[model samples]
Target: MKGKDHFLVAGRITWDFRRLSEEETDWGNKILFLPAAKNMSMLVVESSPWNANDFGIPYPTYFHPAKDSEVFEWQERMRSLERKWLFSFAGAPRPDNPKSIRGQIIDQCRNSKVGKLLECDFRESKCHAPSSIMQMFQGSLFCLQPQGDSYTRRSAFDSMLAGWIPVFFHPGSAYTQYTWHLPKNYTTYSVFIPEDDIRKRNVSIKERLLQIPPEQVKVMRENVINLIPGLIYADPRSELETLKDAFDVSVQAIIDKVTRLRKNMIEGRTEYDNFLEENSWKYALLEEGQREAGGHVWDPFFSKPKPGEDSSSDSNGGTTISADAAKNSWKSEQRDKTQ
Candidate 1:
C-alpha cells in the first residue's frame, strides 16, 4: 500500500452514508462499490460498507454481489496509506424522496426551461442529483447522465437499462466500456465540445440537446418506452412502495453479503484470500492489449517491429512479435488486477 499509492482505509469509515441499512449495524472487511469508485481512494473496513443506491423495506438483499467478486478485487489491489476512524454515528435519508434525481429531471422537462430557452429561469432551478439513484431507464428518453465530479458513474447502467442511450459530456469517457449494446451515434448522445467552447460562446447546456437531429431525438424517446418491460421493475407490487422494489433488492444483497462476511470473520475466516481470487473487472483486457500491440507493431516509435517487404518473411506469417506477447498476457493476474 505504501509503495503503490492506493486507497488506504484504516478502519470503519463511512463511505456511503445515505442508504446505510439498520441490519448492517457496522462495517465488514470487504464491500462492492460502483465501478466509478474502483480506482479511487478507498479503504477496507471490518464493519459492512454501504452501496448507496440500494435500499427499502424488508430489504432488497438478493442482487448484492460478493466482496470477493471482480468489483471488490480491483479495489483490494489498490494501495494507499490508511486513515483511522472513530466515534461512528448513523442516519439514512427518507424514502420515496420526491427530491430524487429522476423526479427533478421530470420536473425540469415539464417546466418551460427547455421549451423557451432564452427566457428560461435558470436561477430558480435546483440541481437534481439524488444521493441514492434508482435506475432512470423506464420513463425517461435520455437518462441525463453527465459526469459526477469525475470521469464515470453508474448512470451508464441507466443508459443500458432504457437503451435510451447515454448523453455524455466527454467523448473519451468510458462509454466504450458499455460496448455495442450502446445505441447508434451515442457520440451524438454525448456532446463533446470542449468546456472552453461553451464558455467562449456562452452556450447553455440545454440548447445543445436541441440541435441534435429530430429523428434521433424521437428514437431516444421510443427507446425509453421500450425499456419499460425490461427495467421498470415493480415485481413484488405494493402501492406506497411503488418504484422501490429493485432498490430494495439491491440493499438486501449488500446486507446478505455483509452478514456472511461478518459471520465468517467471527468464526475465524479471512476474506482477503477470497478477495484475491476474483479479477475479472477488466472486461476489456484483451481488446485494450491488442490495441496497444497494434500500435507498437507498426510503431513509428520503433524500427524492426514495423512491417516491410522482408519483414513478412522474417516473422511468422507477417504477424509482429508484439502480437504474441499481447495475446498471451492479455489475461494474466497482474494484467487483470492492475490493468
Candidate 2:
C-alpha cells in the first residue's frame, strides 16, 4: 500500500491497529492511504477524537440523506414538535463500572420531575427501537449524550434529527469528533457539561438546561436542525443535487488531505515527520493551546495502560487496544499469510 492512493472505510468497526505487522505499520506511516477506522494513524478519518493525521467523521445515523425539499420538510417538522421533557437519557447504567457516570445520570433523570429516563438493559427492547428512541428525543428539549462504549454515539445525531440540543459530557462525544459536519462553536448547537461534573454531582442536568434562556435554546435547536443535511449519509440510489451529506464531506476532506500530503512529499517537506505521528493528538489540538498545557482532557481516554496493570479496562471501558497483544496478533497473521 506504500505510495498508493488507497482509502479503507472501516465503518463502525474499530480496526485493531495492533493487527498490523511491523512492516505493514511502517508502510502505513510512509504511505498516504486513508483508513476510516477507530485506530489513530497518520492518515485516518475516524469517529474517535481528532489527531494530527486523523480527521473526525460522524457515526452513521438511522435515516438516509434526503433532498433539499425533504430535509427542509423534516426541519420544519422538528421545529414544530412539542418537547414536554426538559432533558432525557436513553441508555443503560453501567452500575458495576465505578468510573462511569451513567448510573448517576440515570438516577438524576429518574429523580427529576422534568427529566425522562429510558433505562435500557437486557430487558428493555425500547432502547433498540429507532421509533422509540426518536420519540424520546422528539419529546425532549435536550438529550443527555454521555459517551457510550465509545466516545461518539449515533444518538447524538438522532437527537439533532429531532432538533433536540445534545448535552455532551465530554469533548470526544461531539466537540472534537465531527469537525467537518458540526459547528466549531459548540455552544451554538450543543451544551457541554463536563463528565467530571456529572460524576461529582457538581451540576444538575435539568437545572443547567433550564438556566439557558428560552431564546438561546431556540437558536441552538435551530442550529442543530440546520446541520441535519451535512451530518447524514446520502441515499445511494439517488443524487442529492446540491447539498453534501456526510459521505461527500468526508471524501472531499480525504482528497484534500491526500493532495496536501502528496504536495509536501514532492517538495520534501518534513512537516508530518515521525515525531508528529507519535504525538499526533497534540498537533491536532495545537490551536486549542493544549500543546502548551502538556496534555488534553481526553488524554486519559486514549492513553495506554501502565506496565503490569490489569489491562482489562481503561478509562473508556476496554475500547482501546493493547500494544503487545496487537503486535503478537499481527505476527501470527503474517505467519499465516506466509503459510
Candidate 3:
C-alpha cells in the first residue's frame, strides 16, 4: 500500500507498552524493535484506546471487541440454572511481577469461603478444556477480572458474556479505554475496585459484591447480556445475525470518515485542499508519471483542476469543486514518496 496508493489500515498490533518490561521481559531482542511500528498507519482499529493514544496514532474505532459465538449459549445456560458460587477466578498467576494484583486476588479469593478459585491448569494438563473456564464464570455471581499479559483482558468480556458480573481491578482493564464500546457509566454492568486497594487487602471483592442487592445484581446481569451483541464481532456470513456487530460498526465509521473528509474538501473547509491547490502543477506531472506506470484513471491524486480550469464553485458561485478536485492534494505526497 505504500506505493500502490491505498488507504493505510492498522490494528492493535502491539501489547500494553506501560507494562511491557514486565510482560515482555522474556523477549530480550524483540522488545527493541517493537515501538518502531508506531505512526506507520493512517487509521487504527484497536482494543485499548489508552495504548492507541499513547502511541500517538489516529484510532477511529474499536474493532473485534472481545466477543464469541458461544457467548449467547453460555448466557442462556447460566440464566436458567441458579448461580451456585458467589465469585470465581480461573486465570493463573503472573509470576513475572512479584506483587501482581492477579496473584494477590488468587490468594485472597482462595482463602475466602464465598469465593471459588479454579487453578487453570490447561498448560499442565492436555485434558483440560477451555470451555471449563466459561463453566466457572457461568456458575458464579461475580468474576474476578484482573489485568493479565496486558492492561486489557479478554476474560472480563468472557465473564460478562457468561452472564456474570465482572469485578475489574484496574481502570485500564476495561473502564477508561473502551468508551466507544462499553457503557458510559461502568457501574451499570460491572464493578471497579482499584488495583491498589485489592492488592493491599483494603477492599474485599466479596464484601463489595455482597452489598449489591440481589435485584441490582439481576439488573447488572441483564445489562451484561444486552451488551453482548455490540461487543461481539459477529460472523459476517451468518444470515441469522441482524444486530450491528463490531465489524459492521467499524466499517461504517470508516466510510463515514472518508465521506466527511471528501465533503469538507469539496466545501473548501479542509486544510489539504488549499495546500494541494497551490501545488496543483505537481499533480499534472504525477498523473503523467502514474499513467506511464499503468496506473488507473480514477486515481484520487489527479483530480485537482488545472491553473485556469473550472474550479467547481459553490451554488452561489463561491468557487466550484468536485470530489476529484477535493482529493487532488494527495498527489504531491504520493509523488514525493515515489522519488
Candidate 4:
C-alpha cells in the first residue's frame, strides 16, 4: 500500500479525535484517523486542518450558482446596494465557554453606533431565515466571523455570497483553511482581527475597520464578490458552463495534488516519504520556504500553551492542536510501523 493511489472524501465535518474518549481514540488510531506520512498515497480531502498531503475543501454554502451571467448580475446588484452598517455580526453568545469572544463581540456591536448585531439566541427566528440573513449581510460593509463550534463557519461563505467582506478572528477560520477557494493573500479578500485583541479589550473593531481607506475597502469588497462564483455549489441539475463552482474548484485541486504526489513518488523523491504529516499545515500551506523561513504570519496565533495550561488561555481561543503533541503522535506512529 505504500504507493497505491487512494482518496478519502471526508463528509461535511473534519474529524479531529483529540478530545474523544479513550475507546474512541483507540478506534480512530487503528483506522488512521490521525493520518501520518505512510498515508501519503491516500489523499484525504476534508474541511478541517490536516496534513499537507491532504486537501482542505470549503464547506458548502446555501448559495447555489446557475450560470456566470446570473452570478455577475448578482455581484453588480450587491455592489450597488447601500451599505448602512460599517460592520455586523450574527451569532449566539456562548456565555458558558470562557474562551469564546462572542459575548464581547455582541456587546461591542450593540454599543457601537456604526455596527449592527443580530443575536442568534433561542428567541431570534430571523437568524434561521436565509433571506433575513442575506439582507443583513447585504446592508453591512463587513461581517464579523468569529469561531463557532468549529473554526470554520458556513456564515463566512454566506457573508461572501452577499458580496460583503468577512472579518475573521482566527487564521484557522479562513487563512489556513479553504486555500483552493479563497485568495492566498487573505487581506485581498478579508480582514483579520486577532481574537486575543478582542479578549484583552485592546482593540476596537469599529475603529480598526474605519482605518481602512474607502478605495481599499472597495477593492476588497470586489475581490470578495468575485469569489462568490467559486464559493457556492452550482445546482447539479443545471450545468454552469461559464464558471467553476465549489465542486469544480475542489475536484480540480484534488487532481492537481494527486498528480504532483504521483510524480514525486514515481521520480523517487524521498523528501515526503518520511515527512512528518503533522507539520503539513506549516510546511505545505503556511510556508513555502519551510525551515529556512523566519516564520509565517499566522505562526503567532498557533503557538502551543505551556504544560498544565489550557490552550484557551493563549491568544487563539485554544482551538488548535499543540505542535508538541502532534510531533509526538507522529513519532509514536512511526515507531509502531517500524516494530
What's the distance in Å from true for residue 304, model 2? Answer: 4.2
lDDT of 3: 0.53
**TM-scores for all candidates?**
0.30, 0.78, 0.60, 0.83
In angstroms, the error of model 1 at 258 is: 29
Residues 1-339, candidate 2, lDDT per residue (tens digit)? Answer: 143344556443232432334565431232222344222232222433323434567767787854667777888899999999999999877665466789889989999999999877655368778899999999999999986654656778888888889998877667666776777778899898877677665578877888999999999988988898888877788779888888888788777766766786798874433443434444444454232425566676556556777554564442333233334334534644554
Best by lDDT: 4
After superposition, candidate 2 runs with Cα above 4 Å error: 15-55, 272-275, 282-304, 309-339
Clashing pairs in 4: none
lDDT (C-alpha, whole model) for all candidates:
0.31, 0.67, 0.53, 0.71
Q: Candidate 3: how many backbone clashes? A: 5
Model 1 per-residue lDDT tens digits across residues 1-339:
112222333322222221223445432212334454343333221111112211111112112322223223322321121212100001111123222122223333445332211111123221122222222232233444432212234444434333344454332233322222233344544434332333244344455665777687655544533422222223343322223333344344445546655676678964333232112112222252232212221112112333444422321121122222222223222433542
Task: Between candidates 1 and 3, name the one with more favorable TM-score.
Answer: 3
Instruction: Indicate which candidate wins on TM-score.
Output: 4
Question: Model 2: clashing residue pairs?
Answer: none
Count clashes in each candidate, considering only residues at least 3 apart in sequence or on different chains: 16, 0, 5, 0
Model 2: how far is 247 from its true place, Å?
A: 0.7
